[model samples]
Target: MSVTGAVDWDQWLRRWDAQQTVYLPDRESRFDAMLDVVQALLPETLVALDLASGPGSLSQRLLRRLPKARCIAVDLDPVLLAMGRAVLGNFGRRLAWVEADLRDRAWAERLGVREVDAVLTTTALHWLEPDDVRALCTTLAQLVRPGGVVLNGDHLAFPLHLPTLQQAARTLKGRRLEERRTAPGAEDWDQWWAAIEAVPALRELCAERKRRFAWREKNDTPPPLELYEQALADAGFREVGVIWQNMDNRVLMAVR
Candidate 1:
């Protein structure tokens, strides 16, 4: 369903992107790097799963870049899903929105496809516990076609033993964000959600979103990179490696 009456969907999307940039100063850089990998490795008519696809941001970019590609954008947040459906409905059959929690092992089967060419996620999945991440990786291995790839871009921490490296990376990230503190109309993550709560048309969705995620105690501290590498490898991925990284921020690729 489209957002009711006089909503500037494009403007809302722009605001969302801006808010995200406040957290990750190089957000677009990571997106571009992921797209670059997709174009180089995947077929033109790829079918991809955009797991935890908040507002369909990654799906929108992927479809725009690979015109012939199709995507199943999956997420559980009702507010974000409504916004994504409203904005991306114009893509028709090329883009499908699935409201499924990533924590559900059965989420993959809900996409109505036996296999996809690729599975891509960004700035998501960190909320899952280590066991949940392992389960999700096992599902992805089965869902993605042979020789396909899974690209996960998020802040994957260094091992606890590397305290010096971790501290340095965190300090650099803080300094960079500090430089943009004065940017006009830039909202922090909380502010963005607050704005959404005030939108009359989205009020119901916001409430539903709250209920759906009420059990989520907090975002999990991301597991070390080694866990991800090992999980994918044990799940049957032939090769797993970091294709992109800015300290703890990384795009880990796994080939099935």
Candidate 2:
């Protein structure tokens, strides 16, 4: 499998699907937060889109909360899509899984989704560069109907200064220490990182991708919250602000 340039969907799917058990739980909390934001934005059932919806966590949660809501879970990874189908098949007619790269405009058109009531994504958009992020926001603005919303539940902002990083590190350390003290057997961030490191296939994949991409520990780009808001505004969105925050996790909500 080719590891240079953009990630191939097939390889990504295989790696993720093999480690689904590890990933699924981590994603579940993020999806839970996303569902909360969605509920606050639109109390009633409405058509929704889940962008970069690996394994349909957000879509599945939305269906559980708003049984009448129709959701289209979009992702480029066929293996993950298959996993989503297996996990969320009980939703039957309410949920549809589509395999498509968010970077492609033609795929959106093919979905026949002129306008949706809302759009939600979690822990995925950061994979793209700033330009693609802006373009995605613009596309979403066009895709959502007036009075609709976009809830982005992920880490949208990170401090750049050393002091802030130190503070964040201290906070995270405290959280981890507390977790260990309270729940000794629970999986913490350290464990999560270790688990990923232990996965030979994932390590190999990351190593191969990093050589081509010039992997960096800290991103120099502007905070995702600011970038997203700017893009949303440029795309004709009306209201944009963070509605929820839990440490580094945030939910940025925008209205059209």
Candidate 3:
């Protein structure tokens, strides 16, 4: 069966929230942990950047906690960004949307902020090639003020050099957790994309996505946690490491 009904901004926004929980069962917990790191490192008033921000989900959540915060939401996904602006427009003039291709090294200039108190991303960096991820982090570090925090929440796998049995056990646990995460209302990734494609209103944005992002990279495996830790250190950040983790997915924080 196809989900062919017209998709409104709120419909897609709700579906995006539902689908993220399907993949990340502890979505709320992860958000809490990520924000905890932010509030700990930053004050109530904030100048923030939301990287690879899909439909302004994290931006909305962040503003809910710190309404005075100004956030610049950056992403290459036009469809998602459009829905984000349409649905989250009421968050006030504090939210600004920037369409950016992170693969380009100069994407930071588009952010329109000299330095931010916090830079945050969730479940979105893994899509980048490893080098791009490193560059993105380095750019974020540059954008953040001294002592400001750079936080990434993604599926950062453990070191592949570990013993075989230990890795196998981790894999097994991830599978079991994923199985448990499936709920009646949950939509899988493929299903969500298909639903997006079926909506008549989204035809143009769907075509834009196909043109801009149809190519998959040769490597899909995210770098290990150590690589991120090292990248942060090399980029002149201090106190970098994982703050909270479940299975392969983790929230890593670093102070610049």
Candidate 4:
């Protein structure tokens, strides 16, 4: 399947930055959980790859946990890469920000990063088609060294109680309620939707690409967690399991 065409990098960056500043309530918790999983899998310093790493949040958290470990954070958006560099520049020698499409196999080779100890991605990767997902899993298995791990933190599968289409809506509503109680006056879900609508670049990109921007809205049918486990197994990963979860969101880890 054809992926979405190039987006307006500048506009996309602005909107993404605004969205993150407004809605990253559990950022710390998410990062902490990822660190916990990586530490459990690998005892000492190891190379970590953060795929689709927008703004380097996961990379930064990893750096904090493993100061000596090197991190290669990759993404397709140039603007996001710049933002990540700015945010993580303090880690002078520990972090490397790369701009490349995660869907491309050549990207892995280009990075000159032959083997990784752990790979992590959060709130990303679901944008790809099923075929792309399968290819990514296969590539990940090959790139990761023996005893290395891959952790994906995103909405793995829609909850059984709700229809796939309604899942986004339910999640957005729940987020709004939580924000009202805890982060009052903060830009709630409605505000985020409005922000996306107002951004001409995102609006045009969404219309042109037929991609879903709303929190609960989705385009394709997501496979079950078991399906992902099987995919990893086929890819040569020995141990696969969910490390953390909340509703439909989850952090799945697999060891090669």
TM-score of each: 0.94, 0.69, 0.91, 0.73
Residue-level lDDT tens digits of model 2 in 100-143: 76766666785667989999887677767778778888888889
Error of 2 at 238 (Å): 0.7
Candidates in order have lDDT scores of 0.87, 0.68, 0.81, 0.70
lDDT of 3 by residue, 25-133 (tens): 7888998998887777688888888999989889999998887778889999878887898899847788898999999999999877789998889988778776987
Candidate 3 lowest-lDDT run of ten? 1-10
The prediction achieving the highest TM-score against the true structure is: 1
- Model 1 / residue 9 / CA error / Å: 2.3
What is the lDDT for 21 in model 4?
A: 45
List of clashing residue pairs for candidate 2: none
| Candidate 1 local Cα displacement, residue 94, angstroms | 0.8
> Model 3 off-target regions past 4 Å?
1-7, 164-170, 177-182, 218-220
Q: Write model 1 residue lDDT over 47-146, tens digit each, in one string.
A: 9999999998999999999999999999998778777777788485899989898888888878899999899999888878789999999999999999
What would the TM-score be for candidate 3 when compared with the true structure?
A: 0.91
Error of 4 at 115 (Å): 0.3
Number of clashing residue pairs in every model? 0, 0, 0, 1
RMSD of 4: 6.8
What ordering of candidates by TM-score runs from best to worst?
1, 3, 4, 2
TM-score of 4: 0.73
Deviation from truth (RMSD, Å), model 3: 3.5
